[model samples]
Target: MPVSAAALAESLGRVPPSCGPVRLVAVDGHAGSGKSTFADWLARGEVPVVHLDDVATHDELFGWTRRLRATLLEPLARGADAEVPVYDWVARRFGPAVRVPCAPLVLIEGVGAGRAALRPYLARVLWMDVDQETAGAAGRLRDGPELDAFWARWTRAEREHFAADPTRPFAHATVSRRTGGYAITPGPRAVLDPDFSDTA
Candidate 1:
């Protein structure tokens, strides 16, 4: 069956408060996985989202956990709005900070949104069921050849990150895109993690 945003929202209502009154949901997968697209679909105006891209910088592609913690998570956890700087990839500089208000639901979508450190504060984790190679290619195609060098470094960093802190094994759900919409199923790891038994 299709995973409706309404249904997911209702489910999110049940997960324990990770960020004050907000339910922090993570949409994670390989870089080329359709995470951003899927997150846009799932959000659909029901919730606010903080894309990790805004937190990541050219100098710290995978070293953005600290930035996220300070700018996003910390404030949200205190039931306050967060002012996070947006990184301009082209300029290689962080732009003006953006305010993200505290809401009932929040989505964090990116490759490492479900990292070990962030998982504890997440109400639920969703992994895109796409291979790294395939996703990387799609990402490259979307971004174009101009980013070829960046993609190379990105792939290596992503591989290392996932290898050390695999998010798929801990995700509560797995999402796949179909022609019409997306199909969401219980993650394989959900069965083993007692915390996810309700969804499993």
Candidate 2:
């Protein structure tokens, strides 16, 4: 059976708020690993979501930590609304900013959303269970040749980043597509007692 968002939300609600009064959840995985899809399902278009794509630019893909902290995290941590600047990939510039209000549940979805730097303020981290090769193939198929050169550079950068700081081992749960929906399993970092083989 497919896991329900309400059940997951109930679990997340029990984690205690890590970022001010908001329960911050991170959906992180390899590029094209279905993180965005899972996050969409989890949010169900009701909860607030922040896409890291808006914070990343072509020139500084993974180097937007400072910008994220300044614009998103810091404000939320201070119990205030945050203004996120959207980056225009085609124009290669940051466009208008969007204001994100304080909400009970907030999700951040992207490749490095579960990095160590942000994990401290996250209530839970869910890692998508997809290999890089599979993800890369799917990404290429979806994006086509227009992103071929970009993929080459991204692959190398992703490999180096994950090698230095893997997010899977630290994830509270691992999500993978099942027959009809997704299966969320307890990760190595899950706090459940031994022999509890629960799968949602």
- Among all candidates shown, the one with the greatest TM-score: 2
lDDT (Cα, tens digit) per residue for candidate 2, span 139-194: 88889999999999999999998998899999888888887777677887984222
lDDT of 1 at 117: 91
Candidate 2 residue 193 C-alpha distance from true site, Å = 11
Query: Which candidate leads in lDDT?
Result: 2
Model 1 clash pairs? Answer: 32-135
lDDT (0 to 1) per candidate: 0.83, 0.85
Which residue segments of model 1 deviate by more than 4 Å?
191-200
Instruction: Tally clashing residue pairs in candidate 1.
Output: 1
> TM-score for all predictions?
0.91, 0.94
Residue-level lDDT tens digits of model 1 in 123-185? 888899999989999999999999999999999999999999999999887887765676677
